[model samples]
Target: MTSRHLLWSALGAAAILILIGGGWLWSLPPAPSVTPPLPIAQAERDATIAALKPPKRQRPLIAIIGINDATETTDYLMPYGILKRADVADVVTLATKPGPVTLFPVLKVEPQATTAEFDAQHPDGADYVIVPAMSRDDDPAALQWIRNQAARGAIVVGVCAGAKVVGDAGLLHGKRATTHWYSVKEIRGKHPTLRYVEDRRFVVDDRVATTTGISASMPISLTLIEAIAGRDKARAVGRDIGLPDWDARHESDEFTFTRPFALTAIGNTAAFWARERLGIELKDGVDEVSLALAADAWSRTYRSRAVTFAATADARQSRGGLRIHPEQVASDWPAERLLPSVADRRPADVLDETLHAITARYGARTTDFVAMQMEYPRNRAAQ
Candidate 1:
């Protein structure tokens, strides 16, 4: 009886082991393929169908306003440059003269279009007319023509003190505007009827638009595109252009405090310069302590760009009944492509370093720093 039971037990154990071993020895189940299915909607099919569809590049004919030399490097070019980065806008260099107009350097832009030449046939031409601030806005004829364009539906844009020309033409009588900070008081004084605002990078008063200057021009024009077209389309254009913080600041108009709309002449320029180069405004006043604080803040925040300095005689300059004396001028980018030219580069396009240096140096001082005249790099497209 014991031998039989042992035999039965041993047989049962062997049977179980055999089953387990058999299971392990057997081949594995087949795995599913890793290849993904193609997208259901054929982009190529859509492209083929789309290729047959008519072209969609309805570019706005942007005509720039006429001014002798009051025009700025970025003022006229920023929008032109930024917009040209898109397929939606064709930047026609419109000058008072009908031929080639000379700019910062050998950048003699042959006037492809002109106010009189184009305006004669299409009196109500151009989807947009951009006015850049010049050294002076004394052209009555030009101002009159601008009023005519504004009277029509053309969206008028001004950069920095370019708003002064729009204001002078009576376009900004009730419209709110912003300009280069230094000219704020004088602009307000002359155009007393118009409401004045300050310290803003740019302001869009209804259809009318204005920017502080330089880089601010990028956002201002892009916003205009958003309004005319759609936000998505504007986004595409901005992205296509490589404008990094393009639509990032399109904040909701929620309950929030904004900057003051009025400022002192020197304080305004100081505030503007500090924000762009030094990255913060100087400490409240125009005295040595505040100046040092501004320079000190600049050096700390922008250690790479700013240099040490002591206040010099030429560090100060006076404008509109105020004294602006900065201790130093410096702010530099890490880029190696931005040194001044051996000879003025054709297209008058200088690199950005000089303007940055001048801006940093003259933080609360003279408002006249030469700007980086942009030459739209060949085929101005996002890399």
Candidate 2:
């Protein structure tokens, strides 16, 4: 063949090869981006089964103490949920008296057993006693009960201001401890002997473990679970609960003790009043408006919750015809007093006016209102 003919023949062969290779590649299935689940190790499977199996003798019993209008909701519920979910302990909510225990942030919970009942059932006392922060500091009876539990060698875990209760009970007389940043000074003042450590999410001194704030309950609970079970078991439980990388050593100083405004917005537009009437109107932008008001009210670090004056605990409609649910109601406002109000959406002047009005109402000082928005049920309340 001539030189041009030979070159054309070679190009044709190369083209055919490229087409054949491309066709073969296109016929193959796409590669997976994610890794497939690995089979549980035999030892891990056995350990899990053992951990989950109902104890023939007695499972590690955890008593979560609740007091009337005292217990912080998240502090109590988070540990209870985590321990129970981990299957490391038989967690029970205990109270000074039998009945509904009112938790902060307008939550009402009934304890599974009273102190007397629990004492009667387990004469040796609880393996672990979890205490949440209370509204009042001077509960002689509760303090005494806590002392008794500690004396009986129960691992006493205090969440947030529960450290005060622990201190008041003489548990932290000389032991190192910590609490919510806002109360650190107060705690140190009251219990001068306590070694108040900061920046730690949870601190363990001897048998007692004190956590920083409401959210710290999670990591601390995982720590407890790890101690009761094993690291693998704890990791498995954490994975099951969507907290696969939880570590107790982690510290949360994000919502430090520095005073932050506790703003609660109240009221609902006609559209927010009747949810069934209008489905959900995004154009009205009620949620966005409320978020804007919240954002503008205080520093992003401040705590706030949306509330309405509607009679029932049902969803409300916003002025923009959006169905919205308020975190609280007027009759059952979490705080003793209400802050000033701000419009949902308006000009800068209006926003500034609203902010000014709120600050003036709240005395210009951004007080720490941690209790107002701390505790909430892990699961949804039954309608």
Candidate 3:
């Protein structure tokens, strides 16, 4: 073909292709139209979002630590419930690495995120880091993390004997603290430098908050919730949980917290710490906010039971919410009554007694761990 002919042919083919393509485009069903996201003024939107969400609830992050004396899962969970239910903080579990962390004899909780997984660039940075007491005697990695948390300007609070770990990190050097009365000896044995009001349930020193022990977890959590949220919210949640904090009447040395025994003298400090740290408030009760009222309709019914008041032997019946006979408590168990006030003994005395008894009975659990850690470096003095 001649060059001009070839050019004409190519032009005609191109025209045909264009026409065909155009026809195909026109023939197809109109693509479902997607409304474009409105041109959001980045700065304005950011400002609006900031204002809509109360700044306190957006505390970036809060960590529930794991390590020795952490058997207090309820301590961690109750505060977690307040934080999440109230939505005052981004709660995450921070472990040495990132896996299931065994808590005491019963539970194994996996960390929500690891220390390394924590992104510094996250839009919300952590503002509060809570170190929970572990059941294990010690965990060096978790201790180091606590030191790191303190360095990051995060508010630090220790629940139950977890305070000992914090104190061991030297965070509570001059700070006042309290732990289980049963641990008063070991705590003193482990941290003499830490000031303690053996009777106090919880204590806050500047940026550091410490609890007496497991018993004090709830009260501390409530305190934290109120500090960050508000009294109305805190009270609402207290009522919902049947916290018995109504008149501060929950005070006193001898109120049975739950099924199992605890680490603190009275109030559950972990709960109090969460209450103070994250201001979550949901007022629910046996009435409108019953436990039966699940996110769905298939849940079971519930009750807002009050703490049972213990009555001494024939000490005249007093009118109260729920009365629990002393016999129903330790009074009925002859063995418990005769079990001796061994708790009244000192740590050193107890340790010596334990060692002697163990040596006479089944010997130490294992000698290897003792050899490796015992001589490594203990503060010798509890402080």
Candidate 4:
């Protein structure tokens, strides 16, 4: 054969192979999770709780830290709201700097204090420091502050992909940890010395703790409440939040990057012209946990992004006292653009309700895609 013809033949052969490989991958289901069913026994859970107990103060000072520009909504807010509701610890929200924190996929919140301000106020450091996922994993200021808190005997907790920040801070070395399902491989590779445990919503090894994903924040906060106050207090808070029991139990295997999920995300993204800017109303006494979850979930649909609207441009204080800045005036936002009201639902169940609403509007695959993004287990049968 001529050289050109041979080259053409090789190119055709390569194209055919590429198509076959692509088809195979596209047809295949998500890889089965290798996580085991080894549930954390009560004794083990108690031990972890005890390990994180405050060393000195009767009411431990807890700080939930976020980045100024971009922090994950639920990851930063759920813990603050839940812990505040529990009232077991003196909870404060701190930003890495002095500005309103712009949450990913939704809302903006004013933090209670800046890291520098907190440090100045309490020279002894916080009893527990909660880290949420930020837009940039390698923000030098955040990393240094986390490292300093860990060094000062604060039990550091990393929620969701905040594990990356904690790992970057060099505290997860030689510790057993877990993070968002989507982040497991990347975070594990980043911190090879850390043993990555799965099938649990949260993992604690010594003073450093890590959780599976965004929704895991609720359980982890409950666990922290249990650690500081008692199981009874945690349960009381959990019941009030619509979850009667909260533990480390999680079916990590259930959440994965499946073909259907990928297709839904791709399809939604490709149809960007149809994207809508849905608004949720902000008001005094709104549940911050519910607001965060609802806004975060709706924004992840790819079909829509949630924006907050209030009567005025003024900030609204949540039921738990987090200050939320509305994106627009309520009158300015069209009534049609408002998302299905989650205002009537209990704070904890709003996410599930929003998921159902998504399923109705988009489809089950899109709903699952949103759930997977949040690392929320939608299969109640398995639970």
RMSD of every candidate to native, in Å, equals 27.5, 24.1, 30.0, 7.9
The candidate scoring highest on TM-score is: 4
* Local accuracy by lDDT, each model: 0.45, 0.54, 0.42, 0.82
Q: Count the backbone clashes (under 3 Å) in each candidate.
A: 10, 8, 49, 0
lDDT of 2 by residue, 1-383 (tens): 22222111233244345445565433432321223233335564444333333222247888888776546655665577567667767878877886766554333445778899999998888878888887665678788898998888787889977888788888898887888755788899998889987545567777787877665676677767776777788778666544566433322333432212111111111122321110111222233233223322332112232233334545544332323344444343335334333334332233234345435543343222222123111111110
Candidate 1 local lDDT, 1-383, one digit each (tens)? 12222111233244345445665312422221223223324453333222222122255567776443334434555566555545456556567765444332112233445677768856756667788765456567678778787677676777767777788878877767776644567678888776765434556555566766444565566665665455576667565444433321211111011111111122333343443332221111222212222232232221112222222423331111112222343343324323222122211122223333445554422212122111111111121
Residue-level lDDT of model 3, residues 1-383, one tens digit each, is 22222111233244345445565433432322223223335563333223223223445467777642233444454456555545555676656665555443223345556665664543343566676666443567777767776776666778766776677777877667666544567777777677775334566665677765443555566566666666677667665454535211112132212111111111122233322111111111111111111100110000001111122333112111111122222222233112112223322233234334323322232111111111111111110
Whole-model lDDT, candidate 3? 0.42
How do the residues 1-383 of candidate 4 rate in per-residue lDDT, one tens digit apiece?
Answer: 22222111233244345445677536647644545466668798778888878865889999999888778889999999899888888999999889898887678999999999999999899999999988778889999999999888999999998999999999989999999887899888888898988688888888998999788898888888888888899888888787887667788887775666656665776677998998888889888899999999888887888889988999998888888999988665777777766565666688878898899888887888788888887664122
Query: Where does model 4 exceed 4 Å of error?
Result: 1-21, 24-38, 381-383
Residue-level error in angstroms, candidate 2, position 14:
82
TM-score for each predicted model, relative to the true structure: 0.51, 0.57, 0.49, 0.90
Pick out the ten consecutive residues of candidate 4 with the lowest summed lDDT.
1-10
The most accurate candidate by lDDT is 4
Could you tell me the TM-score of candidate 4? Answer: 0.90
Q: What ranking emerges by lDDT with the best candidate at the front? A: 4, 2, 1, 3
